[model samples]
Target: MTTTFESAAKNIIGAGNRLDTLGLAPATAGNYSMRLADGSIAITVSGAHKGLLEKKDIMRVDASGQPLEDKKPSAETLLHTVLYEQYPEANAILHSHSVPLVVLTNYHSREKFYHLEGYELLKVFPGIKTHDVRVSVPVFDNTQDMEDLGEQVRAVLKDRPASSAFMIRAHGLYGWGRTMNEAAQVVEALEVLLSCELETLKLKKR
Candidate 1:
């Protein structure tokens, strides 16, 4: 079912609050969006603190990311739009910056993907039936050029059609799903996996 702008805004606000409380969306570090009923996107405005988001902080943008409202969207708005265009089933998308993801990605800078295996939380992602499998989450270098970055992301998605989330080196993670709740679940699960990886690395060092 298509969601109205009002409904999308409410969901976005609630999502922001939850993520912020969990320390995922710190300060103004993340952005949240929902694909509205008419195909326009309801996204958080630029520079708004995710934890303190209000209805006025949510603005509309077309599928191609042209602003339909006066408010400016996030600097990485293109990333969210491109994800929606590439994944038709995704209705809600979230980008979050967490300490574990930031540290883990930087600690493994040479790797193009973060691999999670033997994790019970792996079942939270689509199509995974058990904890025996490995999930490779793509990692891309951070860049200010959205067009180039978007192209790189699309190429990766084309190859890995089942990937549910990706990370930006030294930056954050982008996750999405068919619903806002599902999207949050994916992000939360990914965060926990990254946290576990970090803890394991610390144990190895000790």
Candidate 2:
């Protein structure tokens, strides 16, 4: 069944509440989107608090990130669009901000990628069947230029097609999936894993 715009809005609103409750949507720090059945995107409007989003806060945009309505989209809309274009199977995308992610990425700013291994939570992402695997999530420098950042991410992902997520240095995380439910699950799991990594680092320093 093709997802209608109304259905997409509801799913996005529900996701926002879930992410916000999990502390993944701090302030107005994150943006979310769902690819509609008609090929347009249903995304949260710019500057809207994810936890408090209403139907009016959701808007539509073309695949190129151009607004299909009179409202403004998120500043990082291109990032969502790029992901949708790169992975046709991706139907939902979530970008989140968290203390653990912000701290870890900044602390390891010199590293190009962050590795998650030996965790049962790794199975939350698509294609992982065991905790004995290593997933290298690409980390890109934060910038106001969405086009540049999106291009960098696209380039990196082109070589690593299995990757389901990425992080922004000192910024936050981006994760997507074939459905809204799966995307939310991936984002939540990533946040939890990042928190664990932070704890391990703290213990190491003790």
Candidate 1 — what's its lDDT?
0.93
lDDT of 2 by residue, 1-206 (tens): 38789999999999999999998898898999999998999999999999999999999999999999999999999999999998889999999999999999999979999999999999998999999999889999999988799889989998877778999998999999998999999999999999999999999999
Native-vs-model 2 lDDT?
A: 0.93
Model 2 pairs in collision: none
Cα error, residue 38 of model 2, in Å, equals 1.2
**lDDT score, candidate 1, position 59:** 94
Error of 2 at 31 (Å): 0.4
TM-score of each: 0.98, 0.98
What would the TM-score be for candidate 2 when compared with the true structure?
0.98
Error of 1 at 135 (Å): 0.1
- Write candidate 1's Cα lDDT for 84-154 as tens digits: 98888999999999999989888898999889999999999999999999999999999999999999999
Model 1 misses residue 5 by how many Å?
A: 0.4
| Candidate 2 minimal-lDDT segment of 10 residues | 155-164
Q: What's the lDDT for residue 49 in model 2?
A: 97
